[model samples]
Target: MTQAAIPPFHLAFPVHSFAAAREFYGDLLGCPEGRSSADWVDFNFYGHQIVAHLSPDEAGHRATSAVDGDAVPVRHFGVVLSVPQWEALADKLKQADTKFIIEPHIRFKGEVGEQATMFFLDRSGNAVEIKAFANMDSLFAK
Candidate 1:
């Protein structure tokens, strides 16, 4: 769906340092900086709002679950982009030498929910999974 067709989401996550968050999200991922303060910062994450707060005590992925033979992060969040957008972002991340927890590839091949997916952690260890569906309707397929 188009940005105007869906409601934008707000996510509040923890970060160790605002500088790291700014570099990773703002510069690397190309998210635009929004409101911020000494304790937190917000970014326009693909039209959604994501706030990163300085909370060392509550940061990073804590567990994982097996999915299609890979250990998918249990505590992670990210966005669903178009296939072209996902491919472009994947290339950009690779060029930046971004350490991917799960390298970019197609998941669930020939099955429902098939998509292009990649998982990586920010400098502060916040796990993120960016994915794209060839068919957007597959997002919630059963």
Candidate 2:
């Protein structure tokens, strides 16, 4: 028997400004723009649908938790990419002088669930993480 295909997820997040969201999600992250209105915009985030609603009062991180000795934002979202794609993105982000919350590096090295991960905030202060696994099978190990 074969497993069913994964359905695309839809996420709705708040952004302080639509223009900043456009430049971050649409231009920098390369997520194609889908639809837009006076108060919200939609983006194709790595095959997932994400809508950025303009709500300055609801934007930005409010708390964090420590993980692997790093202060990870309590509220964040991202996608799992291939190692090569992650590396290319990391390089591109670095070249753009992106202020990283946690620079791209290997996590859990020499152990189960080893992966490359990075974290940064958008112009509106919403946290975003991008990660890649050396072995996809290890993604669920331990």
Candidate 3:
């Protein structure tokens, strides 16, 4: 069987300011800027299309659920990166003094789905998570 190229996914989320979103996604995270307007901006987020729309009232994460001893934001979206990519991003975040809701650590350690993960909020309080699996096959392990 031939493996097909995965189609890129698109997500639209709220942000209070385009400047802040640009800085966070474009400058800090290294996502390239794409089509943009006064109300919204598109970013090349780890090869996916993510657009930030100006929406003050609906911008921040509002609820959380306890997961493996952390209060994980329920409204978060993220990408699964390689271990090295995860480590580098974690280091960059630390250097930027980014406050983490869930600091970088192994989740589900010594068990199925073991992974390195971190969670933080953007300038508009939108929660974002970045994680990596030591064994990529474990990503959907049962």
| Per-residue C-alpha lDDT of model 3 across residues 108-142, encoded as one tens digit per residue | 99999999999999989999999999888787888
Q: What TM-score does model 1 achieve against the real structure?
A: 0.96
When summed lDDT is taken over every stretch of 10 residues in candidate 3, the lowest stretch is 1-10
Give me the displacement of residue 66 in model 3, in angstroms: 0.9
CA shift at 16, candidate 3, in angstroms? 0.4
Alpha carbon RMSD to native, model 3: 1.7
Superior candidate under TM-score, 2 versus 3: 3
TM-score of each candidate?
Answer: 0.96, 0.95, 0.96
Off by over 4 Å in 3: 1-4
**TM-score of structure candidate 2:** 0.95
Off by over 4 Å in 1: 1-4
Q: Would you list the rank order by lDDT, best first?
A: 3, 1, 2
- Across residues 1-142, which tens digit of lDDT does each residue of candidate 2 receive? 2225657999999999888999998889899999889988999999999999999999999899998888999999999888999999999999989999999999888888888999999989999999999777786777
Segments in model 2 whose C-alpha atoms lie over 4 Å from true places: 1-4
